[model samples]
Target: MARPSEGAARGKPRKIVLVTGGGGGIGRAAAQALGTGGRHVVITDIDASAACETRRLVTASGGTADIVEANLEIAEETANVVEHAAAKGMLAGVVHCAAVFPQRTFARATITDFDQVMGLNFRAAFLLAKAAVPVMEVKGGALVLLTSGAVRLEGADTPFQRPFALYGASKAALDRWALGVAPELRDRGIALHTLTPGAFVETPGTRRIDRRAIPSLPIVPARQVGEAIAWLARNPRMSLAGRRLDATAFGHTWGPG
Candidate 1:
């Protein structure tokens, strides 16, 4: 684990925040924002090159970061990531943004596809929270699980057009699981919550989707979501635990304001 030069010399250990899928999109943005806020960010992603680029961006902004390359879909690897973050310094929070949004309708989707989406999207979160809660209990920490609007079934009657069967199922399962387990984690001084972007944001994954199929909804900047993640990490109040929070609805200023 590499320590910040200034903090190392002064014997001041910086708090660590672990970010999954830190290679690009919201993950990279969160790393940049958290790092700039003076937290030592430990970024894990399957793509070593992309994760390295995120580290460079963090460093350029005068923040410290370390990269770990691992596939979160693998149970062992997910647990190992938490262990690695704990070794760095005081582990403060975890931002889980690694997920696959494959556009597959039920008729076209196979069991293999189901496993792949659920494995990374939901199971990895379970494994991470199980591994991190113990380490965070020493003081306290936060876990922010990225959720999606696809989970709502009110207006999603036409699944064939949207093709979010697998993606929506995975996110819905994650939301229920987090809601069920959050209070228990809260008792242990660990705040667990689900967070949503509140609007569509262009990312490497979403860019693959056909634009015509997507509804004409408001688009949110990725940096705004990053700011929300940083805010949740810095302030893990019990009142906020077990809640599903929307980044845009909070009306909080971005960064140190």
Candidate 2:
């Protein structure tokens, strides 16, 4: 198999995309979306079984796929995951969907809870960027960080709003970081963009939410967001970078290419 950059330099369709948290939900969807015949997808997640299943699904769909079990919360492990993929091919891009949203109100959660959420949801991104940027500098690639609309909509103070403080804060931190790094990434020919589902997606995480009191929110299909991420990865510098794209606005047309 040709390394992604080698093929791209020669005008053939080839790219290696890494999907973190590929066990399920948006991560799995992205792995599947980017697993085109010419694209090699590296699926990593703490859940070994789900990561294996993601590889199986993508391969079954006629796309190339590989699986690596990893725990990204550990900073050094994030580098290891990237290194493993880079060993096989020039990484074309990464879709970071590993996050922890502990639906706990400030009054109910502990300091440790906040620390854990911040570690995985925000700190992990910083570590991944530190590790991946150097590799991408060799041959440009894209970084797709998953943000949340929950962080965008603020100011409404209701009994229900309190439940999301912990989750929202972490995502807000990530959104801010994404904006600050775009210019730096552009200098290296790498594109950096944040993506939001713009609505609820029933996943292992959301299903854990106490839905009865939270009030129903609009939902976007995971498949749509998955395709949008793949579109961004495939297009790279041609696609809009330094912008946060909502699924409703960005994910309507592209099929896997």
User: Who wins the lDDT comparison?
Assistant: 1
**Positional deviation of 53 in candidate 1, in angstroms?**
0.7
User: TM-scores, in order shown?
Assistant: 0.92, 0.90
Report the C-alpha lDDT of model 2 over 14-114, residue by residue, as the tens digit: 56888888889998888888885357888999999988898888877767778888878787888998998887677888888998877676678999999
Q: What is the Cα-based TM-score of model 2?
A: 0.90
Per-prediction RMSD in angstroms? Answer: 2.7, 3.3
* lDDT on C-alpha atoms for all candidate structures: 0.86, 0.80
Clash-forming residue pairs, model 2 = none
Clashes of each: 0, 0
Tens-digit lDDT track for model 1 on 9-125? 578756899999999999999999888878889999999999999999998988889999999988899998999999998888999999998887778899999999999999999
**Model 2 stretches with alpha carbons more than 4 Å out:** 1-14, 153-156, 251-257
